[model samples]
Target: MILFPNAKINLGLDILRRRPDGYHDIETVMIPVPWCDVLEIVPAKGSETTLTVSGRRVDCPPEKNLVMKAYRALAETVELPPVDIFLRKIIPDGAGLGGGSADAAFTLRGLNELFALGLSDSRLAEIAAGLGADCPFFIYNRPMLCTGIGTEFTPAEVSLSGLTIVIVKPPTSVPTAEAYRHTTPSIPQTPIAGIISRPISEWRGRLKNDFEPSVFPAYPSVSEIKEKMEGLGAVYTSMSGSGSSVYGLFDNDILADCLTETFAGSAVFSSKL
Candidate 1:
């Protein structure tokens, strides 16, 4: 089975509070983007499943990789044969792009289809939640208002249709632990969904990621990218999640090339919605 696992960006993130389970109750809208990684799974002729990765460095053993965890996830429930998994990782990790989670979700989906598991998306999601908080979102892979530690979702009536999106990732990566440690939880007076439902032109200063205050002072380059994007006439610009990556929504492609050149030191990607 061959699948392309795409990256996602948080439209607006609010870390409400820390839960008893050591997870945070968050409210945000997550939207899929064209940034993607390639995955291929084939039945193995040998006894054990294997994983091989190329492109961006995953920097983990095969057993520790999310794809293997995905395989084990199904193996625990249904009998699964060993398979050879090949992953081409394009999306950079620690950019808060959900690349690894997307790979895991896609693996679960790929395995289910490859083995005729016949599990519904809901069932798959139930299993996915065990792997990561955002994993379930990729099973649906659409715009959603995520709450309850980001596992629960309600369809978001948000659209970036006819817009260009540019994502820039700097070398600096803010650890998830660090981002959360410095963050103070608060309930927004205005619900993010309500703000997102308004005109895109109204999103600036209004739509915000709760992680920005902590991440910006730590990684100034990431902040610079957001500022530069805004200077380039983006309708809206914000960090995707946590830290390290910033994306801007533009009304046209006229400035896309220029934006790429301007961020030569960073990894830059541009696509149309």
Candidate 2:
């Protein structure tokens, strides 16, 4: 089985409070981006399990990869043979791009169908949440109004089909824990669903990412990318997730190439998923 798992950008993020469990309580609108990772799984021929990865800048030990974790999770319940899993990485790791979570979600989804596990969407979501907060998002793969550790999600109607998105990743690694340490609970709130329903033009200034303040000061380069995107006439610009990646939305492609050329140190390009 082969599947493509896409990355997501947070349109608006609000950290409501810190929870007793160590994770923060958050509310955000997550939208899918065309940027994705590919996963291929085939039945194992021998007793030993095997996994491989390929693509630009792919990092991570094969045994530690999320795909293998997902495979093992299913294997525990069913007496299955070894499986060969291959991951083609495109999204940058630790950039808040949900690369690992996406791969795990795709594995669960693909394996369920491939092995005829007969797991319902809700059941698969249960497994996904065990892996990570972002894992559940890929199970539905659509715009969502997410809250409470990103597991409690409600579907939202929003599309970026006609918009051009410029994704920029500056050279920085943001630890999720550190990002939360600097996060302030007094985050501005907005009608996220309403804002998403409106035209992209209307989203120019009304929406905001709560993580921006906490992350920008820690990583000045990330802040610079956000400012540059705004300067390029993006209708909306914000940092996704905990930190380390920023994206801008423009109405057309005229400024796309220009921005990429200017931001050479940080990888920049226009994409849609």
Candidate 3:
């Protein structure tokens, strides 16, 4: 069976408090983007699990691949037949794009369907949560208001189809742990999710991301990308998650194409979501 696991961006990420479990409590909106990774899984001959990975992020060892871990996680519950999983990765890793979490969630959903597990969406999301905090978002694959280490989800009545997004991933990588370490917990009282769901024209001063303040100063170039996108008539622009990847929203593809051409060498993607 073949399935495409899509990536997601954080609309607004706010660190609320540090929990005793070492994981910080957070309030954020996760929006699904068109950017995706292709995964193919097939029944195998042996009892042992196997995985092959390739594409934008290929440095991860096969043993460390989330698809393998996902398969094993299911194996523990059911004595599954051997499976050959191939991951054609396209999303940038560690850029706060949720590539790994999406893959794990996709595996859970796909395995349930392929093996006739007949698990409900809530059940699949439960398995996804075991894989990672962000994994549950991919189970429904929609824009959501997420909280509680990203396990909680509330659907947002938003449509970003009219806007084109310019996503740029700088060559450098920012570790999630390092990004969180640099951030101080501050809860914004603004009705974050409600504002983003409004028309794109209204997003100019309403939409906000708390991470941009601390992250931009540490990396000026990341801030510059967001600035340039807005300077080119983007209605709203913000850093997706912790750091590294920044996205700008436009009303037309003509502007999006122009921005794409300007950032040719840089890893930039133009799409509508």
Candidate 4:
């Protein structure tokens, strides 16, 4: 079966505190976006499952690829034949866009359906949590208010229905671990959901990503992207996650095309939300 795993952007990310497990406690809103990667899985002629990727090169070895990990993770619980897995990447990684996690989550869903193994989304999301914190969000693929290192989820009422989204990923990639090391976790007085409920124009200073303070100083290009978007009259602008990818929401379509053209060499995507 074939599946297209889409990307997601963090509407607002707050690092609440450091946990006992060394993972930080976080609260964020994740909004699904249409930017996607292509994955296909089919019964294999050989005895072992395999993975091959095209388009944007994955930085890790195949054995370490999340796609293969997802297959193995599922195989551990159920009977399965070997399969040939193919992935075509369109979404850029390390953009805090949840591309890899989305791929892994979609793999589990695809496998379950392809093999006729009945599993509810809740069950799948439960399984996905073992893969990555944000992996579970893709199982439902909708607006979600996430907490607990980004694994726990509750449906979010927020919507970008009438807006246009423009995303730009600069040439560099941020190391998530490094970003965390440099960050200081603190709870916001006003919750992210509350800020989101306000007018989009009011989101400027209230809705924030805790990672931006450290990320922007280190990666000015990413910072520049946010600045440019604001200068271009974006009603709301923020770096999606830790670093390297920034998104802006606009009320009209005019600047979406212009932003795409402005950042030609980067991985730029524009779509109506």
The candidate that wins on lDDT is 1
Question: Candidate 2's residue-wise lDDT over 187-225, tens digit each?
Answer: 555567767778877886777777777788778999988
Report lDDT per candidate: 0.92, 0.81, 0.81, 0.91
- Model 1 lDDT per residue over 109-215, tens place: 99999889999999999999999988999999999999998999999998999999999999889899899999999999999998997999998888989999999
* Candidate 1 positional error at 45, Å: 2.5
Question: Please, what are the lDDT tens digits per residue for candidate 4 over residues 1-273?
Answer: 889999999999999999999999999999999999999999997988989999998889999998888888888878889999999999999899999999999999999999999989998888888888889999999999999989889999998998988889998999999999999999899999999999888999999999999999999889989988888779999998886799999998855467667776788898888
Clash pairs for candidate 1: none
Against the correct fold, how does model 3 do in TM-score?
Answer: 0.93
Poorest 10 consecutive residues by lDDT, candidate 3: 254-263
| Number of the top-ranking candidate, with TM-score as the measure | 1
Best of the two (1, 2) by lDDT: 1
Model 3 agreement with the true structure over 91-171: per-residue lDDT tens digits: 988678898889998998888888998778998788778888888899999988898988999887777777788788887
lDDT of 2 at 49: 78
What are the clashing pairs of model 3? none
Worst 10 residues of 2 by lDDT: 264-273
Clash number for model 2? 2
Candidate 4 versus truth, CA RMSD in Å, comes to: 1.3
Q: What is the lDDT of residue 55 in candidate 4?
A: 97
